[model samples]
Target: MSVLKGKKILLGISGGIAAYKTASLVRLFIKSGAEVKVVMTPASKDFITPLTLSTLSKNPVFSDFYQEEDENPIWNNHVDLALWADLFIIAPATANTLSKMANGNCDNLLLAVYLSAKCPVYFAPAMDLDMYKHPTTIANFHKLQLFGNQMIPAEKGELASGLSGEGRMAEPETILDFLEKDWQDKLPLKGKKILITAGPTYEAIDPVRFIGNHSSGKMGYAIANKAFEWGAQVILISGPTHLQVNYPEIEVHRVTTASEMLESCKDNFESVDIIIAAAAVADYKPKVVSEQKIKKSDLEIDIVLEKTTDILAYMGAHKKKQFLVGFALETENEFQNALQKIEKKNLDLIVLNSLNDTGSGFGTSTNKVTLITKSFEKEERPLQSKEAVAEDILNKIIQNYEV
Candidate 1:
């Protein structure tokens, strides 16, 4: 999932040929799961229709301070609009708009919102090559940066004037990448590598049957996505599950049996800064393998079983500088069992969830958990979405671990 998910973005469009690109930009933001509201300069409507942008953003385009259609005038509150956004972006920022913004000239609703916004502001300048290189434009750019506005520099490309030098608005994908990277730089886990195992391992009994748990991998996948959002390079080793994650920072490895998961973890553990074992791996597998499907007959058949290798224990025994976390699912004495696992596996932290909790446990989107440290420090959390739980877990790790 995108770090941009659920973020409220205020998009400001200024008049320029580049204004046409804002349609694709708004579409990109919406595709990334962000809520978009567009505020265009009056002149910008000449370049791109409000209907097109509104259709893409799913919000009415605001170009004026009041609605003329209503017999009773309804004022558009710029302050309210400014406060509602997590980020404010001005694309196709024309020379006129840039000058007004740098000088605090609130001539339009978009400019008024920029002046009132407390959120981070970004502007992508676009114009003819000569106009872009003008001393006044350069001064405005520097002044805006001084006022805490981020600038997405114009790319070098052919301009509408049939001249190629610079001053072309950045492409939609580039702008999104820029925003994502900027968000990442402010995260606590920036540049850190995280190794996570998720889902339930399947131990094959025969060609037609297998041993598996009810784990949907929702919790683990949530954690991986959260870590990636916090700028961690994540290696998600997953067992058989239906869940899928779409993030550039995560590399997923699929596996079946416990042995496969163990090998993948071991192979990648040395390169990671943190390890989280969230997979509900089977404790044992059938020792004898039947090449064909075991037919269901009147006679009862016995299959010998053997204990699987203890992955967490092995990781703890071979601990270096990496922070190790484990998960414990218990039906009774949850706290004591989790604490014991923390000690036994030499885990830096353990997350405990009870099957008895109504909103928690397997196949649910919500979870109630108790976070326990090796030092026996415990923090209990109420039921929340798995995504929120993942954030809480990462926050706790950030608090306890130095890196």
Candidate 2:
């Protein structure tokens, strides 16, 4: 799969003959599985219509700061756009725009976004050879570079001026290649393998009834996606949940019962470098399961319960070089219970989620968590999206465990 998959790419188009090339560039980015957002200079709309780029990108192209068509016009916040992007690319950057960017001139919304962006910025300059070689253009290029902007050097090709020499924007395919190579080199978990268990395991009591928790598998799936983005080969052993793994790097094994989940984890445990037991495996299961559903006529019913397999403890005991992580969901004594689990399971780290916190716990998109280590270190994180929480957990693991 392409490294650009799931990336947020902000494509900035300026007034130039090569502005038309941005259509192909947006298509390439989308084809590579990236979310592309186009921001065009007002003059760029004259060369290529915003409708064309917007349709291809599947996002409304932004040029003006506000929507004047509405009774109460909404302001398009440039800072938010700047912070939202994974990378910003300015294709067909004209000398006028380049000069404005280098001099910190924020005349247009595009320029304002450029000035505020915290992510990496790349510019592809396009103009006639004479204009491209001008002293002012050269100075602006150097200034932008000194400010940490990467220049995708204009290619030598046939120009609109009927002169052919180093003034055309790089081809869309070439630009894509450059981005993929650069991102690949920066992936921290490129060669690592991660095994994650997620969702609630259902312990079957009968054909029609089972024991299960309210776990929606959001937390675990979020972790799996984040790990895949970091270039790890992820083995997501998930319980019965509606969640789906979209990344090619993630191999998912779906299971329903606690026994099935345990077997799945054991099968993949030895091959993985990191193991995260995030699944809410049932502790007890009915000892005697009826082949047929229990009749409702009984005045009272009795079902014997027995302990289920401890997957985390089993993996922890058998661990060699793998970093074992566990999760503790508690309603009381959260920290103590989590710490006890870490010691009993021999986990390298444990994530604690308490039901006391609003907007946390199962079936929610947000989470409030406390990360505890075997060494008694604790870090508390406020309520955040599950995806952000997943990234935090992975960051801790990478910092302390990854060699």
Candidate 3:
């Protein structure tokens, strides 16, 4: 009983070392009963030839809009291609392809198809440690997250970069797990507009430096991704994170600072059926930033700090019938603080995490959470993958909303 039985998926492959993984990914999709189709970028051919993918998918690989002019006038029409899938999975989404998707740059058939895709869109990025860590790459990631794309967080492993760090593409099995999660018949939050804020927001101190936290956006992005799988119209207003967008029904907006996040939240809050504030926004920022890099001086530099606006409180005051959710990451008195926020922010439910818990908080792949509701009833759960934790949250929401 595979969830993907009869599902039609369009697998988009780009130029990257991890492109080789798609061959097996296609096989997994097919074995699970999905009708898999392949779309390759011109650069993708350099890593894994289209012929190989064609053989695996058992369908013609689409590269250019113009079909070969040998005995057939039929072209690879981007318009028709966009409508041919229940989902689109773009693996090994190189930095260039991500940036193009971010800015809606349609220069080729792949870009055109992506732009025109009315179905769910998924991207898996692969790159070296340095390129993945570059500021531009981080910024592009933020762009995709804000665009409401679903991102499969890269696994940490030895990379082609010769250095050990973050940048590896997710394993094919992991991607398959998330891709088919939405196959259930029940649409609990169907037609509801939910907005999720995720990742770590940056507070600029200088052009070269910013105050940030270790929010992987894992929890929030997982919530956003799962919500879309349930057929909700999700708008993910995210901070800076190395993630890509997903659901065609989900739109994303990116922000970097407390102010930027607040602004984006307010813009979308009115139309939302629910709002989840899972981002780790900076608590303070330099009151006055020096225009240029402050040269080393013998004098002690005192950076006056100011508190950032609390997004949850702001929305709480303006909230209507829409359900509101908040995340509390505490170091001490965790339950007390979470209870206060549930009342203070008028949240229907709040997810509680403590820095004290080993696997639950910070940048870990797993989390232990306590779900607190309006009556202060709590459900303490053991550690699980961020993806599973997200499902737990959504399940609670669905039960509450009776969707």
> Which candidate number has the best TM-score?
2
List pairs with backbone clashes in candidate 1: none
Overall lDDT per candidate, in order of appearance = 0.93, 0.92, 0.85
Candidate 1 lDDT score relative to the true structure: 0.93
Q: What's the C-alpha lDDT at position 274 in model 3? A: 87
| Candidate 2 lDDT by residue in tens digits, 355-374 | 99999999999999999988
Model 2's lDDT to the true fold?
A: 0.92
- In angstroms, the error of model 3 at 329 is 0.5
- lDDT per residue for candidate 3 within 1-403, as digits (tens), equals 4557667899988888899889899999999888988888888899898888888889999988876766775678887888999888789888889889988898777888899898878888888878888999889888887876778778889887677878899999989987766445446776788899999999887888888998988888888988876777888988999887555556888888989999999888888888888999888888887788878889997889999988889898898788888899999999999998998888899999888888889789999999988878889989899989999998887767633
Model 1 residue 400 lDDT score:
88
Query: Which candidate order results from sorting by lDDT in descending order?
Result: 1, 2, 3
Give stretches of model 1 more than 4 Å off: 1-8, 14-35, 42-48, 55-58, 71-86, 92-119, 125-147, 153-181, 184-188, 205-207, 247-249, 287-305
Q: Give per-model TM-scores.
A: 0.76, 0.87, 0.57
Q: Where in model 3 is the C-alpha error above 4 Å?
A: 1-185
TM-score of model 3 vs. true structure: 0.57
